[model samples]
Target: MRVLYCGDVVGRSGREVVIEKVPELRKSLKLDFVVVNGENAASGFGITEKITNSFYESGVDCIVLGNHSFDQKEIMNIMSSDKKLIRPVNYPEGTPGRGAAVFKTARGKSILIIQAMGRVFMDPLDDPFAAVDRLLNGNRLGSQHDFILVDLHAEATSEKMAMGHFCDGRASAVVGSHQHVPTADAMIFPGGTAYQTDAGMCGDYHSVIGMQKDEPLRRFTRKIPGGRFTPALGAATLCGILIETNDETGLATSIEPIRIGGHLKPTL
Candidate 1:
């Protein structure tokens, strides 16, 4: 199974780029499934139902959310009916949307997608490790799924890496989000799970992690909110990881970082 996990999509620019490129990329790459982080897909805040549907129309099989999942109040209601969208699993039991789901790819293969949040430098929530274990033991093992992808929406790189190692032999791939800066490390673990510390943001690379550089710079240097952060209008790069998993075991065989367009150098 070949899966493409895209990094966080920021604001209008990010969505526009995906809408423009993904269809062609899917056909040319022979992709089996595509998962995108939609935490910032609206206006660098939360996702909206319309934006989520737009992503689906653009060939995204599963949409993953992070800390900003509920930033848009309407999503609470939309999540109740939308099975294709997922929020963090570590939230309380009665959270609006599901944290994990089984989706059928365009080719009809079953794929399990999970979204998990990290504890370090994040909201105090339920144990993510425990949540993942429960989900796998209950929904994944016996299900005739051919591919499994985990979106570790986290702030800490160490925590994300730990999660990847914990699920090494169980999941096909573990990709991180939220940091917005793509990491260089993309490798398959000994247990066959593909892992990357951060998949980066599909936004303008010329700015500060997709936001206008001036605001963050001012906040850090002067310790004051001089202005609101805005999405950079420059060309955006779609950053992500591509993983090829074994058909029988659903474990990764190869993994590589994917960075295309914008200011960053292209990667395979």
Candidate 2:
């Protein structure tokens, strides 16, 4: 199975870029499933139902959320009906949306998508390692599903790498998000899991992460909020990780960082 896991989609520019380029990339790569982190798909905050649907229409099979999952209040109700949309598994039990789901690829292969948020340097939440253990043990991927992909939403690179090692051999791929800067360490782990510390953001690279640079710079310099942060208007890139998994064992055979379009050089 070939799976593509996109990084965080910042705002309008991110969404527009994905909608415009994902379809062609999907076709050219012959992707079996596409999972995207859409926590910031709306406007550098939270995802809306409309934007989530747009991701689906643009060839995304599953949409994962992070700390900003609930920033958009409207998603609280819409998530109840959208099974493809997922929030962090480490969130408390009463969270609105699910953290994991199974999606069938066009070729009929069952792909399990799981989203988990790290607690270090992030909002206090349940233990991500424990949450992932419970989910995987409950689902029994090798027997119940053909492929398993985990999105480790985190701020610290160490935590993301730790989680990837923890899930090695069990998950087909483990990719990180939230920092917005793409890392160069995309490779298949010794135990068969494809891993990357960060898959980067799908928004403009010309700004701070995906927001306008001025506000972030101001906050850093002045230590005060002067104005609301807005999404950068420059052209965006679709950044992600591409993994090819073994058909029988459901383990990753190869992994590559993918960056296409906009100011970033294409990486595959």
Candidate 3:
């Protein structure tokens, strides 16, 4: 199973980048499945039903959310109905939406996608490891599911790394999000799981983590609010991680970091 998991989509630049490049990447890379974090897709807050629809039309197989998963009030309505869109599994009980799902790829293989939010530096939630473990209890990685992908939307790298190791042989890939900056590390773990500390954001890198620079800068220096935070209008760099898993073992055989367009252009 070949999967491309994109980072957080922040506002218009992020959305546009995915709409523009995903189709091309899908064909060129021969991706079987695509997972994108749409936590910040709607004006840098939470994603709406329309944005989710657009992403699906652009070939996104599944969408994941993070701490900002509920910023958009409309999400409460659409999430229950949209199986492709999942919220954090650890977001307490009866959160109105799914936290994990089993999806069939174009090739008709079943893949399990789970999204969990870290507790550190984030809203308090259930123990993510325990939450995911309950689902994986009887579910074998290669047999019950062709592949398993975990999106650990976290703030701490330490926590992300621990989760990767915890699910090393169980999951095919474990990717991180929410820090919004691509990390240099992208490798297949010793246990065959492809791991990355963060997949970064699918938005402009010219500003602070895809947001307009002015307000963040002003707040940092003056400690005062000047204007509202908005997405940067500059060209965006679609950041993500591509993992190719073994067909038999359902483990990652190769992994690579992807950064395209914007100031941080890639040769690939």
lDDT against the true structure, each candidate: 0.88, 0.90, 0.92
The alpha-carbon lDDT assigned to residue 151 of candidate 3 equals 90
TM per model?
A: 0.96, 0.97, 0.98
- lDDT (Cα, tens digit) per residue for candidate 2, span 13-91: 9999889888998889999988889999888999988898888898888899999999998998888689999999888
Worst 10 residues of 3 by lDDT: 131-140
Query: What RMSD, rounded to one decimal, does every model reach?
Result: 1.3, 1.0, 0.9
**TM-score, structure 1 vs. true:** 0.96
Winner by TM-score = 3
RMSD (Cα, Å) of model 1: 1.3
Give the runs in model 1 whose Cα sits over 4 Å from its true position. 140-143
Clashing pairs in 1: none
Q: Candidate 2 has what TM-score?
A: 0.97
What order do candidates take by lDDT, descending? Answer: 3, 2, 1
